[model samples]
Target: MSDTGRRSRILQAAIADGLLHPQRAPLAAFMDWERVTSNVQHLMHAFPSHLTTLHAFAVKANSLVPVLTRLRELGMGAEVASNGELTAALRAGFAPERIVFDSPAKSWQELRRALELGVSLNIDNFQELERVRQILSETPSTSEIGIRLNPQVGTGGIAAMSTAGVHSKFGVPLDDPGMREQLIAAYLENPWLRRAHTHVGSQGCPLPLIARGVNELVRFADEVNLRAGFAQVRTLDIGGGLPVDFETDAPIAAFDEYVAELHEGASRLFSGDYAIVTEFGRSILAKHGFIAAYVEYTKQVGGRDIAITHAGAQIATRTVFMPEAWPLRIEGFTESGEAKPTGTAVVQDVAGPCCFAGDLVARGRELPRLVPGDIVTLLDTGAYYASNPFAYNSLPVPGVYGVSMAAGARPEFSVVREAQLDLELTAVATE
Candidate 1:
């Protein structure tokens, strides 16, 4: 079935099951389980089985425990940046060895904990490496410690999203004067540093840009090992930056193109000598998830039709704050979950239920006229929309459902996360 058809049925089933209500629960997120499973399966098979590749899901993308648990079940590892993400990974049943600890501002306590747990570590800077060295002197850890390298590969389309820019604050700059010698010396001096890491950017980064960054990482690893007089850098964490297609449901093609680019630009990725780690977050979950909000009211402002929905900065923070960078495809559905008739295309604004004037998700877009009691869906939003919600207007975090829309099967909705209460401190045990 087409993505739109499947989405309509899933929401229809959700409404029938009372998981989505126009009055009581105006906002709810849905993730297609089959689509997510298919995505993971393709990635698992993208490389040869002989090549050691740890596909670690970046926990920052969707921090929900239920989502993490499902990912863990699919034989995917966790790439955690913050201590809270680490805890969430553990709670979701990720093995210690399968978790990778990476963060620019990791506390000493966080480093010690990860080391003790035997999780991999990517030290962001020299100061963090010194602390790790000190900790190792007192207590030996089996952890594979590495340094994050800034490849200076230049920026992608989004300036703020680029992490490998010349002035990026992510990792050690390689192109800076004297830095190559300094980095090689650091690796040679520290035998514990057996890995090198680089994540150029997210979303806006293209496959070619990502491949270039990986090529730099592999080259640096070869240089470091050559200087160390042995295979010192045995692992490479080529951070995930496979851009997703927000315009349509096109994730599998992106991954296929990504593998092709890696083969062309970074063939060393498949070399049998080193183990590979990938921290893909958005690409894994974005295409399979969507946000549905009930349009509470309609109005005409400056001779333009407007739809005020329950979705806004609370659920779609990026869209509300940076609409141009994060443009969302808004679809209209009836209160009963059927597609709203597109008889006449009306150019109008789709506003969210936020007090701010800048909460419009779509500006002067041609779409079916949305009315009160209609549902407005934000497509391709599984990774960051509802999962990375803002506390603006003190809006409650909407419940998220894992939907099964298999062929010839009835649509089913399983609770991935329950709606958050105002005073609730602990997460709901949905899994």
Candidate 2:
């Protein structure tokens, strides 16, 4: 389908699924799962044979059960960062081999659980490797593992999110000759080590920068094959940093372009066979969903306009606080319930109802003349927004909804999870 036509239809499906709620709930968030699943399918089709093993959706991006279930059904794998994520993945029906467990500071129990379950574990440190060894010895399971190697390449949308480069705390530094030697020796000694992976972080990643990182990964894989004397590494996870629509006019990373580039890089860097795997979180789901917020009140302060909405940084902290901003498109509705074409005009700040003065959603930005009860759409928030929400000031988690659209079929949408409330009652009133 044409891009415009597809977007329109998806929007229509979202509205039908209640994704476009007229106002935000007291403590509810919503998602368009059908659009997200379809996007995944589209990506898989776009890459076809070039993509291997499977694309694992990063659970940290959005761990809503419905999202996980949809991805599980889509034949995509699960990339988990904690025991909760692992449990969530399993609960959503993801197989052991189809799930990737990667975290910098994993607990001993978590490691043991991963070993017991035969999940794909990505080891991040020598200490963690030792823990894995201890766990395997006790469990005696022939588990597959991957080593996360940080190339120190430095690529990210914001400095905080970038996992690559000199200052990163993630993965063993691939450039450190001594560290590389240690990793290889450890891998050679451990029978469970099966794959090598790296992620430079997410958001606003320049395409060329990621292409370079992929080349580095392929080269590192080649080195592992030659130095470690291992052949046919089953997986080479390049790590997910595919850019989502966050401010600027930066176009979405072309899946074909990236895969083709990566494939060519791999062919040049290695002779051993491997599956090119990616653990995409944001890019896969972000653009496919949004958060609908109702303006609670509006005020003019010091010659600046502030439209306060129920949606706040608590739900989408990254986009609001991170140096990188997500796309924010505001649609104005008149009291007559008629849509108004308010050019590209902008507003100063969109505030949330939080205790702290710093609690804001989108700031120093442009939006329409928003008033109380109008809806403000936070576009491309499907990835990390709702999934990583913060209840810093005791805000309740939001509700999530799912929607589906297929060829020659009616659109389908439903509330996957209800909006939860934070009932802080001092006493139950014993009687």
Candidate 3:
């Protein structure tokens, strides 16, 4: 609740002063810089017991330079998944060591580039580990190495994001007997190995799942260090998967509570020597962003009210493209006053302007009587929506604006990326 008033003021300002590009009216998404920074500050205060060496913000969440720059100013690091994200991190002023490279299928060229920059590499699998070994053996020493471990906890917003589950394709599983010993042996044999890491899942809500993963990870880390007989382990990277409050009034997981539990779990197993690192992607940036799109049209389908929005699965696929879900409502912008809630009280199915029959955002839920030009603000669109857009349909992507929760703040967002242009050949009418 810190700076709650400031957050409101900044959000109001964004609705008032943000400049939309030509043809990109009624901005699609806006990031609240102040609120995001405040979240970071809250996290820093929460984990006072541990040397939080690097609160690396996941770049894949929102790779916008303004977003990255704002996070950098808050003394946060960057967790990049690809060479392009690494480039964005560097451009945004992250130190080489502050950048953590993670990917299951990285090209040798990308690995070489990161190594050359001295960034930390979180090797995904044994094959990638051997690839690193071969590359580093030949090339001059460049990058520090870390291994990503899968606690196999199986939790997240959706099955697709659940990386720690038994069937996950991420990090080497720690539960398997002798797997820990093998990984430790690999690290002991490799001089570049200095860090061990793991991520349970993304968009995780329940804190207990995270605690389980961390506790188990600490046991694994302790075993690795004891077996190696060397204090080469300086970093324990518990990858980020903090959730954000969308349209629901329900409370999101407190940043401090999560950190405290994680710290306690780590403390129960290991002493005070290594830095406890967290890569928070969505929770750090999601709440601070809002997606404001105009209501396109209204229809009565199946005896229900359906309001189509300008933003579709092309922009927010996870939320909109699903087996029907309801997003939390933070605010409503319309010309009418206190419209009657006559529609179904349940979660309504809101569809986007896609041709697919299954393009409904939400289904069979109650929403206010809507009309064209009314604005709908998707509560938390800052994380994966903008950067991880679906390029299947050539729908015109809307403009993104960055807002600060500070006084006298103006629109300061650049095109983190341009939307893909639609091209179709039709017979031209001769003038």
Candidate 4:
């Protein structure tokens, strides 16, 4: 069956099997296991056999325990940015050695935990490096450490998603006066600082800009190694910001294109001198997941059609907050979960259930005329949508299910998370 047909069938079966309740309106985020596995395999194949590459999934994208568990099972590692994410990775059974802790504002307690657990960490600033030094003096432990560098290669389409912008707050600015010399000094001071990391940006970043940023990182590492007269840095953490094609039905991100760009822009990257580490969050899981919501109402205002769905600011926080930067495709379906027939399309705004007027998933998009009780599937939401929900109206968190399908067999679905209940929300406060 075609991709659309197959997805429709899965939704239909989910409804029939009582996995989704139309009354609840917004239900579950569905993950395609097979597609996720294929994407992982494609990334693994892109690297040469001599290079040891760790494709660490950024836990900030989708911190669902089951998702992390599956990624670990696929020989992937975890790149956590917070203590909660580190906890999630550990609970998901990721080995301490396979986890890399990265955060600009990590607390002393968090740093102590990381050191005790023996997970790799990236120091964000010179002050943070001093903190690590203090910790080592007090309680020394074997933990791989690195410094994050900002190549200052220009910003991407979205300024918010740009990590290497002129005024970006992420790694140490490499172009700052005397900053490059200071960074090298830090590495020379601490031989344990054996890794280098750089993440240019994410959704809006261009391929060439990303390549340029990584090339700078490789060059910085090379200089550090040469100046120190020792191969202190053995790994390069080229952070992941591979943009996904939201306008297409492609189930995978452009992994091959990204690798080719890196190879061409930074030929020294694959010299078998250093192992590679990647912190890919969105590109790995974004295309393999989607959100299915119920259209609760339809209205016409000033000659424009509007669909009020259950997937507004709660699930699609970015799309609602910054519509242009995070536009999502909304596919309309009949009340029975079948695809709506092609007809004279109308420009419709898919609004969420939040009280605010800005809680819209899509604005002025042409789609089939939506009606009450219709199903509206939000495409390409696998990464940040459901996993990063905003409790604006205290709406219950939706359930998420991992679905697997084999040829000539029934589709199997397992609950990766359960739908939150009203009482469950208050239970914590009462306790």
Best by TM-score: 4
- Each model's lDDT: 0.89, 0.70, 0.70, 0.89
lDDT per residue for candidate 3 within 304-325, as digits (tens), equals: 7777776667777877665434
Summed backbone clashes in each candidate are 0, 12, 15, 0
| TM-score of decoy 2 | 0.86
Report how far off residue 185 is in candidate 3 (Å). 1.6
Tens digits of per-residue lDDT, candidate 2, 12-100, equal: 55555554445435334445555565567766875546435578889998887878888888888999999899989999999898888
lDDT of 1 by residue, 1-431 (tens): 76787888988898898877886688999988888998999999886789888999999999999999999999999999999999999999999989998899999899999999999999999899889999999999999889999999999988888999999999999899998889899998888799999999998987888899999999999988877889989999998878888997774636677888999999987888789999999999999899999999999988989989999888888888888889999899999999877797799899888888999889999989988999989999999889988888877789999988668788887888997644333344432
Segments of candidate 2 deviating more than 4 angstroms: 1-28, 48-51, 228-232, 247-253, 264-266, 269-272, 323-327, 334-338, 343-346, 405-412, 422-431
Q: How close is each model in CA RMSD to the real structure?
A: 2.8, 3.8, 4.2, 1.9
Deviation (Å) of 107 in candidate 4: 0.6
TM-score of 3: 0.86
